[model samples]
Target: MPCCKTCTTALYITAPARCSPNGMKYLLPVRLLLLTSCLYRRLTSASTMAAMWPKVILFRDSITQYSFKDGGWGAVLADKLQRRCDVLNRGISGYNTKFGSIILPKIITKETASNVAMVTIFFGANDASLPEINPQQHVPVIKYKHYLQSMIDYLKAIEINEERIILIGPPPVDEKAWEVECIKKGSTLNRKLAVTGEYSKACCEVADTNNINCIDLWTSMQKVQNWSEFLADGLHLSKKGAAFLEETLTPIVLKKLEYVGLQFPYWADIDRDDPAKTIEAYNPYCPSQ
Candidate 1:
């Protein structure tokens, strides 16, 4: 939390000048000197003080992959976090935790980990697929738990600590509606509400074991009256459901952002007569300094 050295030094570069006649005569030269000095300091410390957008990675399955659709939950999040953070969609369709575990390292590497402010792990619906009907996407309950734990462990290894991670359990399924979709493909229902609840429970267990945050969508949606309206195809979220997701998740994301200020000064704050004075001294990295 300590301010960077470059910004700390920049703060003491000058004091406010008086508006006396002598001060006015030297104002232009003083402004140019201050600008030059500030530029030099910033350039010298570019490696550590360079501008970079902190990221919030949304890593999950089909539900997440389609979160940016018209009026989707991901789109809502992106809008809420416009300038403060970059919300990266790393969702892959039809992915179970097994495949997610295999590819997580490649998606989030050591190089990118430094700038990652947060990550949301959302999976389980696909893993809970009925093995007898859809063996390809179905994963055993026990292995699903293992895969979740492994992913959490791997993220911590790369320095994205548990504090920055959020586990989102699967939402409740509308078995009857999903069955209709299955019938269109010449198949019977391949998912059950009870089965998905098991995976959702397992997702929360991993989160609890690691002492990270969790969004138990499965339990939450089920508590609401007429929960079926929350889903589009018994599995994916409807527009109403996406709004609920935003309402639930936005508070948590905002809590994490309490200490993060806007990246740059407001346009109106730029001094018209001496723009360089404000521009050179403004330290987005260390607003307090």
Candidate 2:
């Protein structure tokens, strides 16, 4: 059989299109056993099955939702992981910590939690909004941190563990530039740079308290001298900005994954002529007694 666009089809796997130097493009939710009918039948003798791919969940607001756009952070991770893991995104625009805490459990339940390799909690952009201007999205700085901690603990209850969780603070807002974008959208500026920093700081503090790794997007970007270039409309990440974030975050996630071996059997580990011959080799089921 011919190989996938990027990866060899030795193990009967499909290669994702839009392969970035950093992430995977057009990665759908696929189970390993369901990859092909031949392999599925060959593995039927095995009594247990593992998820085709482990998952790295991107849980956050709009910043995360747009991560798959234009070689963004999310897209880049998919590429880096190859078919080793699935980069699952659950981003909702205009959501703050207040609403996020309520919806967190619904998406990350015991079932989803079991196969997860890591989860990134990125929020606070909307929470950092000025209450007077963006009341619906505003979250008092103190409550914002509380909600973050609450989420960390919730994941722990399901055994996701502290080591697998990462917290990301809001990026620095460019007040003047964002104001111009707001006006173009027929609205006044609803956020301020200085005030947004508070929520970002709070996010870092929560990460500290929980002993979780944190990506301080606010401080890190501001150090760039011309940090405003990182934002597309003075708020959302532009292509350059997304690249910056992807570069900064890559090492952190990779380091955490050092302890986690790649998912499934590597191409070399598979039997080229009988792809399913080694299905039980890397299986999580039937661990040695």
Candidate 3:
């Protein structure tokens, strides 16, 4: 009897040119089974590969929120750590350490902390606001220090130790430039460089007491001839300022992740002829096992 069209197609694909009709009938089922198994293995292996990439959480205020903007520091870090780790931004605009401490636990729980390779605690810009001018945002410098310490303690409790934490203090403000913003909002200058310096100093003290790293943006930017250029509205970071931050933070991040390498083999190492060989080697759920 003549083979059916389905069988004929399977025969051409899976059997030799001289394959008998009976042989095609037997080979098709085995070939289909092997193909299905390979596909399943590839799917599971892809998920496992993704899970292997560590996470770097950027937990901060508007600076970090705006970090993904053009020329933003967060974008720079994301590019620098691509394939090695996932850079997650958890920035909240106008948030102070008091609110940040309250929210940190909700975001970084014990279940998810183990996967975090690094976390940046960047706050205090809003906290340093003058209470008389910006009562809603202002957090006392003393409370700010306690809040930061509490956050560090919480992260440690959840397994994110001091070595994996970095504190970024508030950046310097430009009174001349910021006054324009304050006027637009119907208020006199609500943030002052001197007040911000006080908070930044407190941030460094906390980092020192906890024995963790810190990026004193307030002091670092002022070292330049015209630091105000770094501030977009005499508060937020401009592109240049963001780049400066990226340059400073990248080295520390690299040091922390020195031992971690690329997640998988380079593309050139993949075997094109039998890709399954490479896939199976890396796949822990390979059927043969």
- Tell me, by TM-score, which candidate is best: 1
Q: Residue 254 of candidate 2: its Cα lDDT?
A: 83
Stretches of candidate 1 exceeding 4 Å from the true structure: 1-51, 273-277, 285-288
Residue-pair clashes, model 2: 7
* Candidate rank order under TM-score: 1, 3, 2
User: Clashing pairs in model 3?
Assistant: none
Give the whole-model CA lDDT for all candidates, comma-separated: 0.81, 0.76, 0.81
What is the TM-score (0 to 1) of candidate 2?
A: 0.79
RMSD of each: 11.5, 12.9, 16.1
lDDT of 1: 0.81
Tens digit of lDDT per residue, candidate 2, span 1-289?
3222111232434454335744542333332322332243223333343443568899999999989986788999889976556888899888988898999999898656656778999999999888887899999998998899899989987757787899988998999999998899888999888898898889888988889999888999999889999998899998888888888888998876653445455668778888766655654221221
Q: Give the residue spans of candidate 2 off by over 4 A.
A: 1-52, 271-275, 283-289
- Lowest lDDT 10-residue stretch of candidate 1: 37-46
Q: Mark the regions of model 3 whose C-alpha exceeds 4 Å error after superposition.
A: 1-47, 273-289
Error of 1 at 38 (Å): 22
TM-score of each model, paired residue for residue: 0.81, 0.79, 0.79
Residue 74 local lDDT, model 2:
91
- lDDT for predicted candidate 2 compared with the true structure: 0.76
